[model samples]
Target: MTLTAVMSAPPVTVAPDVPLSEAARLMAEADVGCLPVVAADGSLLGVVTDRDLTVRWLASGADPSAEVAAVMSAPAVTVRADHTVDHAYRLFRRTGVRRLPVVRGGRPVGMLSVDDLLIDALRRFADLLGPVSGSILHDDTEQGFRSPGPRTVDTNGPESPVVGDVMSRALVAVGADASFQEVTDLLQHWRTGSVPVLSGDGRVVGVVSEADLLRAQDERAAEDPARLTARRLMTAPAVTVHPDTAPSDAARLIVDRGLRRLPVIDTEDRLVGSVHRGDLLAAAGRHATDLADRVRFALLAAVHPDAFSQLSVRADDGLVVLDGRLPRGIGADEVAHLIRSVPGVREVDVTARPSGPAEVHGDS
Candidate 1:
């Protein structure tokens, strides 16, 4: 479907000349995390988000009366109103930005966000699965099947890459007593949205994000900003994941919690590394490619050299397709089963035909 069908239309906008305080007020009143900075002609010039306000203005203790253009992210990545949802997904993966401005003739008309795409995807899944689930339950009842208790499914097989495989091991963390400037400096130097606040024993106690710093600046107006510390400005009980966690689960947690990054912790809740949405997305693509290679290798090992040479394998988003000629002893079902044994393959499709006498033997 096109973006127009799913995008939020008539987006709230702010002028480039608007003061940072005014922009913040508009964001609060509109209940949005970002606002498009538009020119007088309605053309999108840039986008200013809560992160920008916090990290650029509040963290720097810049004048609130300063223009938003000074802090807005410019040359904004955008999507055309007529673009397909698939196109938008690619843009999201490529740009690593959660929101995109929808434009028409260089004029801002709407906004598209990851949340919109996620909701649409969930709705589509419901539409597709609801009837199937009902039929399944009906068949079970008619067959005199009994309920099965909850069971644990192990998703972290050797083939499935865990968070640790993709997480950035180079961590930039701060202690609870770190000065506010130190935290801001670390954020700027690392170019990260948030920093994990560690306890005395090196366990994550909280997270100091741009939002947290912004709140501290806003609420503690009279206090000296230099005296502020991570403990005074952090959000407690940080949402963390372990290294063994599946990348998919980590991605889900990030989306569900509206988090930009997740701190990876050890069994003892000690900070180990970090993972971002972009890392998870890249890992998915890499996993698909790796699965395809494994599938090819499996075919090579199971089938005759000639037949394997003729076979073609393709994998996309965990679905594997195999096409070619199968030897007399091997059936399509057998080939499919072999492919399915590969750990990362979710589904397998085989279109290989039985080889004829001449094809199987080196006969003319």
Candidate 2:
């Protein structure tokens, strides 16, 4: 499929002369991470993202009244609306950008995002699985056997790590009435981009970020900065997750929502901790290492000790690679299948040669 088939059309665009605060407001209103900065004629100029606002503008202490051009990533990497989804995928992989502006005739027409591709893939997968699933249910019914509904993961189990496992229990939060100075101090002290704003009942009500503060500062330039309160600056109805939430799910939420952090709440909806993008990444790395260890252990049990010793196992981001020699009667595909059966193994690569002794050459 082409980008036109899946991309969001008439994407929210910003003009170069738009104020930084206005760009940020547009993003918040559209619930988008980035906006394509277009020329008056609707030609693509650059792209600005939430990160640009935070790092280039807020962190750098740049004036909030600065134009979007000042912080936007110029000469943006773009894709054609007619380009194949595969081409877009390659651009994403090469550029390491989560979103791309789709252009036609050098004019921004749409926007393509990794999330859009993922959703398309999932829809295709569901289409392929639907018939098989229906067949299974039909056979089960005909056999007078009740098919159990979908199985849910037991988060309490050791196999699956939850948000509680990786979230920072030491949380820095602010009351709804916290002064702007107090919020800034807390953010600086905690070294976090944002902090959860809690209500009088200690329930998370919103989030206040550096971008928010900058916007507030610019909008209320006449007012005393110190008089601004968290409630007035916070993004209301904060997106949150529970302690039992899966780390992968939390990461997805953070990325999809372009959020720097998610407040971890308990049954009472009271903030207990927070999980940041970095925290999820560190956890994922650790999980990949642990999975590698598990793959090695499983290989050791499945193969001869000598062969297992000769094999090398490595994993990164859930892709496991096994290389070396396997004993006679063992096939690479067999080993790959074994590895694939392991939970959390997204993919497996096996390159093994049958073990054999070096032959002595006879005099010719």
Candidate 3:
């Protein structure tokens, strides 16, 4: 289960002193999105992905001859080669990064990717089918195990949908001192309802909504508009959601506070992304594979590993079937209700038992 068993070792790498163009050519040759930037001694320096090349270099018009270190994302997020796949899955969900450098003793050893996880998962599922195939075909209760009835997607549940699961990663934020004209132009360009206002240190200080701008224009004369800045028009002490916040609670806050947009902040209250009402609703229809990962991570995050250790999850069409045992004193219905709130989970059918040996429940 450790990364050592699955990671692709002796990964392709690039030197920090290499030109950005050379890095791009290497990536193309290797057919990979990223390359670990390493020092002469083979120590990990940082990582440069296609996104870094596109966003920090090409999009910004940086010279192709610039060093790779100039554009690489530093303090690279990594995992130990001995860590479990579950640990790697947590990193993938929490950091929202597609590739992670697998290291040992502070040196890059291999690469772990989402595609790698998927292949491993498929192999595991294939292995499982060999043992259960007979029981499935000759089941005495086959007639009673008919298809589930039509069920609407459930949104109101105790389980929280983490804001990180649904927040927009492509952020369009403005500085507190940005001119009103600049703010309006950005809003129109991004077509977002509001822009999170950030301080020089990147912490969110306020938010400027379309309503705030309209109110400012309506209440003030045209001559005074030129004097306005984001600091002047934004609503301070902004209402925001943490990346771990449940979408239901966020939605409730939006409705009760009449908010069109909620800024997503990290532990340091730095602006990371924004979530709107539509994002919450649209999340219910995310790709099945993504939803499966989200549900798995959510369960792993909220419930103790011992509780979900034996858990096996399969996405049937849009329904998530959770098969395993619940922690002692936990009810199957509770687990099922929790699974229903995960994005893209149209329905949940739990076939789990209490911690101790007992009669297995068919489904809940």
Among the numbered candidates, top TM-score falls to 1
Candidate 3 lowest-lDDT run of ten: 129-138
Candidate 2: regions farther than 4 A off:
58-65, 84-90, 114-162, 165-194, 198-203, 209-218, 236-239, 245-261, 267-270, 275-364
Give the clashing residue pairs of candidate 1, or none.
none
Scored against the true structure, residue 292 in model 2 reaches a CA lDDT of 79
What TM-scores do the predictions have? 0.62, 0.55, 0.42
Query: In model 2, what is the error at residue 95, expressed in angstroms?
Result: 3.2
Q: Which tens-of-lDDT digit does each residue in 181-239 have in candidate 1?
A: 88888888887778999999998888988666655655556677666889988887777
**lDDT (tens digit, per residue) of candidate 3 on 1-364:** 6788778878899999898777877775665667999989888888998667645664354676799989898878888877667667656766778789998887889998855664444333332112221111112263432211112224684443355788988778999888767876776677555788989999888888655654454333345545788988887767777766645555555555555577877768787888876565434334223666667645644433434677787886779988876665457887788778776779888887677553222111
Per-residue lDDT value at 285 in model 1: 43
lDDT scores for all predictions? Answer: 0.71, 0.70, 0.66
Better model by TM-score, 1 or 3?
1
**Reference-based TM-score, model 2:** 0.55
Angstrom error of the Cα, residue 198, model 1: value is: 1.0
Ranking by lDDT: 1, 2, 3
Candidate 3: what lDDT? 0.66
Residue-level lDDT for 324 in candidate 3: 75
List the RMSD of every prediction in angstroms: 13.6, 13.7, 18.1
